[model samples]
Target: MSSPSTLSPWRLSVAPMMDWTDRHCRYLHRLLTRHTLLYTEMVTTGALMHGSELRHLRFNAEEHPVALQLGGSEADELARAARMGERWGYDEINLNCGCPSERVQRGAFGACLMAEPQTVADGVKAMRDAVSIPVTVKHRIGIDKTESYEFVRDFVGTVADAGCEVFIVHARNAWLQGLSPKENREVPPLRYELAYRLKQDFPQLTVAVNGGITTNAQIAEHLRHVDGAMLGREAYHHPWLMTTWDETFFGDAPAQRSRDWVEDEMVRYMERAHAEDGCPWYAIARHMLGLRHGLRGARKWRQVWSDHRLKPLPPREVWAMAQAHVCNESDVLVA
Candidate 1:
């Protein structure tokens, strides 16, 4: 297994979704694909500087090639945050410039940073100077209907000049006002062409496209234009799509495993996490509900795992109840 530095780590990745791509979710994704890069949910600089380090930075060792996404606009703060991420063993430090939530706007960061390209450049330079690891940026194509391609192009050029090599471009405008974050994701028109054009202009940089990309065929098509493609909610809801990514994208041999095998592995992880810190099984179990996606008995299997009535049961018992459905046994508990 080559280090992410040794290989192109951006080829196929899961987007850094807030409240969704936690350590538990990342561990599950790693089980299904060994090569795809994973990202931590956006962690603000203040959280790392003022909050619990272990709570914000801790991740499973299995989630190698994972990048830490920092949400901040201050150069000094971002540099300090990047250093902490490096010291904690993250493969890369990514600056988030593409979130449209009002809370983020009040903090003076996220998608609003797109309007201040020089500030982003200074922060990128600060992080690059502070850490030996790679520093990357994820940004939107435009913000609040500033649809000119020049806006994003100049943003990328300015940041690239700061020695940042990777840019993950979400091909949508972020409407900063009158739109909830959920609505922002749905309402923005996808202009993948701008991202492709970024690659054409900045031939020296590695650019990955995101937003509205779901299927493997779409990923393959985007790869023809950009260096990589990132999946967000689609990857979260139907993660089994990643089971074939290595073989299809990286040309590795198919994994000789089943959803059952992956579920068993997660059960072991849940048990261990519980024994170590009293973490509940349901917490970890929820990340794997989509493991049996599209397969026969998947709904029943999911129902058993998610059943609130079974919260008090040990994870191993829940696993048994979920497996009973797959094995054609009629005596197990059901939601």
Candidate 2:
């Protein structure tokens, strides 16, 4: 491991989701589990290059041990963007080559870059040279129909040579030309065996598996073969699943929070959103909708806050509604 201090000891992490894993989501996950590494939504080099500081890069320092994921192909541009991440106290810089969105393809990045491993190697090298923090890669096994495991094997070999010590592999093919980004996430068949093989072949690099990983058992199984696991949709939809991660994966102190306590914590965060310009309380609350999943009255809890009529209510009041729903469930069951 290149500077194990720079990388997360948690090993298990949350993937860099597009719209779903924003600052608010990251904050919520951080609250649930103290040790799991979190990632920012993939911020393009163009956005970081020309956009406002607060909009493009501002994040609460509480969201530390966080990696800032970047989408770009230019070496110099990525290097400059990486330095900005370092300045902003981001723990790692991750290059994205797994996304299959058309917009990303148009930009000559994302899964399309899989065909250009040399460019990715150059970008990784440039970013690695520019920042003291670890520069990592989150990518797919192959693009389109190039299903050969050797292809991914070589991709890791080439990039790993450039000092990119960590690889978060989405264990699936990206049908770059035909599938919509959402479809790409689903339609492709997963080949986890290949990811395990990559880990075996490249023992020196920290290989983490992503894509459709949901349960603690699955994580433990993958960890047997690979160094880590990255959760995506599962973490977003049932975030409470992360409650065990500290003790289960990272070997840290368990987070001391009840469901009610978590709702209370949201009230404080909501106040922060209200004080900050451009942050809507709902932007933060939307991520919390899943916080109550599988609990009694979760539907009422979600419906109460998700209702548009509730939109005009104050942040504290919205949280109050969620609390009331939880209380109501307890009352009914007790009766």
lDDT of 1 by residue, 87-142 (tens): 99999999999999999999999999999999999999999999999999999999
The Cα error of candidate 1 at residue 258, in Å, is 0.6
Q: Which portions of model 1 show Cα errors greater than 4 Å?
A: 1-7, 327-335
**TM-score on alpha carbons, each prediction:** 0.95, 0.94
lDDT tens digits, residues 115-216, model 2? 888999999999999999999999999999889999998898999888999999999999988788888888999999999999889888889999989899
Give the candidate number with the greatest lDDT.
Answer: 1
Clashing pairs in 1: none
Off by over 4 Å in 2: 1-10, 327-335
* Weakest ten-residue segment in model 2 by summed lDDT: 326-335
